[model samples]
Every structure is written in C-alpha cells, then in structure tokens.
Target: MCRWLAYSGSPILLEELLYRPSPSLIDQSLHAQMGAEATNGDGFGVGWYGLDTTMRDMPDTRGPDVPVLFRGVEPAWNDQNLRELARSTSSGLFFAHLRASTGSPVQQTNCHPFRHDRWLWMHNGLIRDFALLKRDLALAVDPALYPSIEGSTDSEVMFHLALTFGLTDDPVAAVERMVGFVEATGRRHGVEHPVQMTVATSDGERLWSFRYSSEHQSRTLYVSAAISTLRNLYPDNPAFVGLSDETRVVVSEPVGSFAGAWQPFPESSYGIVQPGDDVIGDFRPREP
Candidate 1:
C-alpha cells in the first residue's frame, strides 16, 4: 500500500517530478487519484543519483557516485525540507515514494524507496498473509545481507529476496522467482492470493517497473509515452514543450491530464528502460 514514481532521463530538478506536475507524487500523498487510499501520509522517501564528483578523472567505470537519500516519518506534502531540496537538486535517475503503511509503523525506516548499495527499490502492494511468510522470506535472504535489514515492511523483505535471487544479474527473473517463492510459501501457510504488486527498481542507470498480482487483476501502473510523442500530441501545452525525447516517467498514475501521453502497463507484464532517448523494452509472461 503505497505510491511511487521513478524518473530516468535528462537531468531535472526533483521538484519537476515531485511537486510541479498537476498530480505529482506529492499531490498523490495527500489526494491520490488511483491508489487504494486517498492519503498516503504514513511516511516518505526520495533517492537520487548525480554525477560522481569523486571520479572526474576515471571515465572507464561508473565510479563511486553515492545516491543522496532523504526520508522522514512525516507526509511528503508536509515536509518543507523536501520541497526545498526538490527545488535545489537535480538528477538523471530518481525515485520518490509515499507510504500508506499497511501494518508497519509510521516511522522513517518503514518508508518506501528502500536502498542498498547502488540499488533503490519501492513497491505499491503487499504480500498477502505476510506475517505467515515473513520468517521464510527473511531467512531466504543471504545471511550476509540480512543484517542490513532495518525495517518491518514486506516491501523491504521483498527487495532482499530479489537480491538473494540475483537481482543485480537478472532483475526480471529474480523478481519472478521472488513472486513464485512468496506465492509458494504463502500457499503453504494458507494465503489464497499470495501477492499483489506494482514495483520499481533502479541501479542508478536503468529502471525496471513491474505490474502483477496472483489474480488476473492488479493495481495501476503506467509509463509515460515518449516525451517527443507527448509534445506532438499536446503541442499547445507549455509544460511539455521543453521536454526532450529522453524524458520518461513511470508512476502509479498519470501526473497530469495530457491525454494519450500516458499508457497503462499491461497486466502481468514489466518494462525495462535502457540508456537511450525514449527507448523502452516491454516483457510479458513467457509461455507456460
């Protein structure tokens, strides 16, 4: 139970995505349009990557560009510091999440957009009967990575499971395996529909977004049509006029009423965004 947005493209100030849009992530925190709840004020977080200032000399490796993170137990819309930072910092890849804390406490650590090393993750759904499967899923994580666990949310545990299943190498397969394992474990413990999710993750370069549920129906998740296409469609809208082809956003819902500028991700599918101007890779379930 949360709402999130992931942006990867030409560098833009965080406010451009978190506050300026008509139905920005901050607006969703107070008045979500498609989320299960109207207010997702339990907690919030933002993670972003910028040029690795320390590696100015080395062009071979991506370098030690540490992500900047800001999280708090307060609602996103209510945080003055968030607004201040959003206006000041800029990044090519960033993630923002507002929580509707299911069973977890309304604390800073329980916020979405959990991070590990260079990876950042956020989820908008739950693992049904989590209490029953928590122990099993937690144990499934590599013991070495277990100590890093700091929160009590199912979303955080799911991140670790994906890592254990080799997310860094194969995010799609790792996530599928994670869902399979969670479903299997949940069924063994009597949960009818073991999972529901619309999740996003990034390693500061590429972004992966997935929409799935044990049942055929799942929560809302959408990716913006290419900015070039949107600009063409809404030629008179000044807000979209300056956006380049590389600008892309994936969110739980559209950020504004630019018709045809957003498309719903098909149920039971995932999308991968690579480093290019508006290039997208779409994936569906493999044949049984």
Candidate 2:
C-alpha cells in the first residue's frame, strides 16, 4: 500500500506538512509505521491549488487556477527536486503521495494524485485481482472520459471510473458507485475481497475522503482534529500558529504524534471538508 495526505485551508508552505512535522509525510515515505510496506519508493507526486503571486494582482492573466502537479519516478526521500518544490510552493489545498507499486511499473505517469480539470485524486490501496478485472472495469468508463486515463495503475482507473459515474456533481455517491462496480466486476472474476481503499480527492475548493474495504479491514486513515479543538487542547503548540479554524487534513496515517491531533476515520465511511461544518457520514456502495 501507499501513504498519502490531503490538506485544506490556510495557505502555507507545503513543507510544513510534507517535511517539517516530526514524522512527516517525507519521513513516512521511508519509515511508514501503518503502511503495507516500510518503503514507498516506486514514485511520488504532489498537487496543489495556488496562483502565482506575481499573477494574483492581475486576475485575468492568471487564467484558470487549476492545481499544479510535480511528480517523479524516484523515491520521494531521495528527490532533491521534490524537497525544493515543497519548500517553494504554498497552497490552501494540496495532496502528496508516496507510491509503493502493487504490481504496476514504476514510472512518472503511474504516480498518484491523478488529475482532470480542476480535480485531484490519490489512493492508498488496491483493486484486488486487478489484472483479472481490468478489462471489464475499463470498458465501463464513459467513452469520452476513457481517453483521459493516462496511466496503467488501478488508482488511475478508479479515478476515471468515479468521474464516469458523476464525481463532479456528487463525489461521495460517485465513489460509492465506483466501488460497487469494482466489487461487482471482481465477483464475476472469482475474487473474494474486491476493493481495499483509503482515497482522498479535491476540486480546488472542497475535499472528500473515503475509507472502505470489501472485507471490512481497510488500511489506516486519519483526519486532523479541528484546528480550534486542537488549539484549545494545546494552547501553546507552535503548529497551531497561522492555521485557520477551517484548516484540516486527511492522511493514510498520522503525520505526527501530537496528542489528540489525529482521529481515525471509521471503517466504511466518508468525510467532507468544506466552507462551513465538515461532515462525517456512513458510506454505502451503490450499483452504477
């Protein structure tokens, strides 16, 4: 499996989460305590929503403020470019992933945080028996959207499947449908546990995360406690400085060990972080 994180609210240097934490995302890339593998060295990717400071004053010149992507086929901890990029960039919302390929090739295109339009997606688990079910799942994608799949990883396919099922209009429902279809397809191929995932996605505005497995033993996933709550809990923690009440993050595992800073996402559930109150609700797969 992989280790990934999604952050929203309060634009700050990406390194604050990617590297500055005690056991940060970069540290997890090599020493992940909750991942299937200790080392996620196949590849890495980071996607963030930010406008160039130089262009912020000229709104029209900024064009569309789509997320920017920086991916590499090298180990994240070993990549100087990744470190430089993380330090130089800041975003109100961003996603970072360390990939440990299940069976796919190690390549730049196979990295996580796949993109389409203003959306970004990344997954930390697999579609069991993917080789046996790939054909059927690929055929189910809408023809117009099928061509957008640029990688051979099941993670990419899952994203396109969600898009085909209407992610833009309703993200949680689309993912439920996507998982349902994958499970149905896998059953036909004789795979018992068809899906295992802890997925995070964002549309440059709101962020959504899902944790589920057909066998009901999904990988670990954590969401940061509300900034206000954490601040009250640890009034002098430097980490809370400059963070907004709306600041939130969802991770495959806790990025740091600060007391009460992270909470486990319930099994087979989904959560959304948006403008007002964030929501955590039960997730049920539906037939696409």
**Quick one: best lDDT, which candidate?**
2
Clashes of 1: 0
Q: How many residue pairs clash in each candidate at the backbone level?
A: 0, 0
TM-score against truth, every candidate: 0.91, 0.97
- Model 2, 1-288: lDDT tens digits are 899999999998999999999899999989999999999999999998987586577655424657888999999999999999888888899999999999999988999889998899999999998999999999999999998988899999999999999999999999999999999999989999999999999888999999999999999999999898998998888879789989999999898778899999999999999999999999899888
Candidate 1 lDDT, tens digit per residue, 1-288?
A: 788999988788899989988877899998998889999999889988875345457663534555667999988888999999899888889999989987878888888788888888999999887888899889889998999899999999999988988889988888888888888888889899988999999888889999999886899999989877877788887776766676789999888767787889888888888766433344433211
**Candidate 2: 10-residue stretch with minimal lDDT:** 54-63
User: For each candidate, what is the lDDT?
Assistant: 0.84, 0.92
Model 2 residue 194 distance off true place after TM-score fit, in angstroms: 0.6
- True-structure RMSD, every candidate: 3.3, 1.5
Score candidate 1 by TM-score against the native: 0.91
Q: Where does model 1 exceed 4 Å of error?
A: 51-63, 277-288
